[model samples]
Target: MVTGLTLLHTSPAHVPVFDALRDREHPGAVLRHLVYPELLERARAHGPESVAEDLRGLLGDAGGPVLVTCSTLGAVAEALAPALGAPVLRVDRPMAAEAVRTGPRIAVLATVESTLAPTAELLAEEADGRPVSVRTRLVEGAWELFVAGGTARHLAAVAEAVDAVTDADVIVLAQASMAGAAPLARTRVPVLSSPGPGLAAALRLCGADTTAAPPA
Candidate 1:
């Protein structure tokens, strides 16, 4: 079994994305969820590193390499990288890079306020001094729908939020949980999700080819 670790601020939003990527390498892989208390808003205020340490403590002795997933925990992930000695699956970096590459006017949508700085920094770095304009917005109360089992409704609200940031060439869902709403966010704009690049990187780091499905 190919086991991994995921830190979820809400319900199983990251699970489907991970499962989709896992199926390409380890079909029916057993996923271990390290559920931390809902830290969406708190993550920004308290810092993600502390939360990551809390998660690391929760994952005691669960062997095999692990991948930590978080949309708002980039700083925490960077801090935890050395300790975990495993690839930390931060959703913002790649998504930001992709958004910058696609367009100058980028819209970043997130539930947490802390995600903006790191995301903006990453986009600026990827733009290579090019005059790329970035616009960011926050969507409050959307993650609640996912926790209430209203995945579709939550996604639609996210799409509506993305639509609110009009005249942008690309839209980036800063939260991994927000990734499930990508299909609905297709409004004449390219919507990028963390799972696509994050999972691809995870597979490569695990020495697996992402092209073929994992063994059943």
Candidate 2:
């Protein structure tokens, strides 16, 4: 099935990563990418309503399932989902669920401050009153590197930020863009990527066979 790849970052680097991952988990699936690099900055400076308006506009024209990949916009996507005609899913939902399961102590890592609250809220909602603790860490100066097209440096900074998690059962990578940082981090705790599980959830919601999807 065709899927709309909604993003708030302008870089082409995330495209190949998502493509490889989508193909690996669901071969031959069609994808249409839509990116607006300044969307998050707007959300941070302005508010989600402004971003949601654009998201709603995109959803109106999207032909198939829509997967919003920006962690900062996850809450906005979910808020807009019920009103849309097609399936609208946030990339971090599944990962947040998995994090709660591993939690009591979960550390969420993000390069942007706009991402932390929404991510933490999602984890809390998924926690289901069984006692889950969330700690948010911002990888200092990382977002600037991304804006400057220094992806390798941006990812390296995120990996280095993992060192700040003093005690945690698992670490949650708040953005799909941070997935690459997992292996680069020098941490013993399990690091989970949002997009992998998110795509899996989207495929399942669409009634597609996800037999090719790898284990978490």
Candidate 3:
């Protein structure tokens, strides 16, 4: 029995993206959620090592590949890489590279403040002093909409936020929670969702080519 693992922050905004990917691969695979409001509250309260331990515990003895998704949890995945002993996908890196390649002006929208640092660092490194212009903004109340069962509202807010960043050539939605908002995030620029890249990476890690058509 092959199993695939993926982690989501306590937010349900990621449901659509995860559900879509899961239906494509393992229809009934288990999904683990790690909630740490305290850890997420403070900017420097914890690091990846602490988050990784929580992940290992939540994913106890699950024998399969794991794909972790979180804008603020990338460092956590990095810390857990040694322990999980399986392929871990950090959703932002690929998106960052894609953003850099798209053009000079890149706009990143995220709900959490923690995501800003790593995202900026990743983009800077990927840009490699190409004089790329990077701008970031926090979607002030979008996450609350997700928690309050207002997914559509959240998507609308995200679209509005993206629209506000019209100067960008490409927009990167940093949080997986923001994935559902991708389709609604109408922009003259390209909107890159974490799930697309994350799912692609997960398929590659599992050695599965998801490029095939879905069942009729």
Q: Across residues 93-189, which tens digit of lDDT does each residue of candidate 3 receive?
A: 7788888999989888987677877787778988988888888898999877866878788888988898788677999888777877777766678
Q: Which ranges of candidate 1 are over 4 A from the true structure? A: 1-10, 24-32, 38-45, 55-65, 213-216
Cα lDDT computed for each candidate against the true fold: 0.67, 0.79, 0.70
Q: Residue-wise lDDT of candidate 1 within 13-101, one digit each (tens)?
A: 56666777666655544456554546554675776554666656543344434455665666565556667665555556667777887
TM-score ranking of the models: 2, 3, 1
State, as a TM-score between 0 and 1, how close model 2 is to the true structure: 0.90
Better of 1 and 3 by TM-score: 3
* Candidate 2, superposed: residue stretches over 4 Å from native: 1-11, 213-216
The clash number for model 2 is 0
TM-scores for all candidates: the values are 0.78, 0.90, 0.79
* Number of the top-ranking candidate, with lDDT as the measure: 2
- What's the residue-level lDDT of 75 in candidate 1? 52
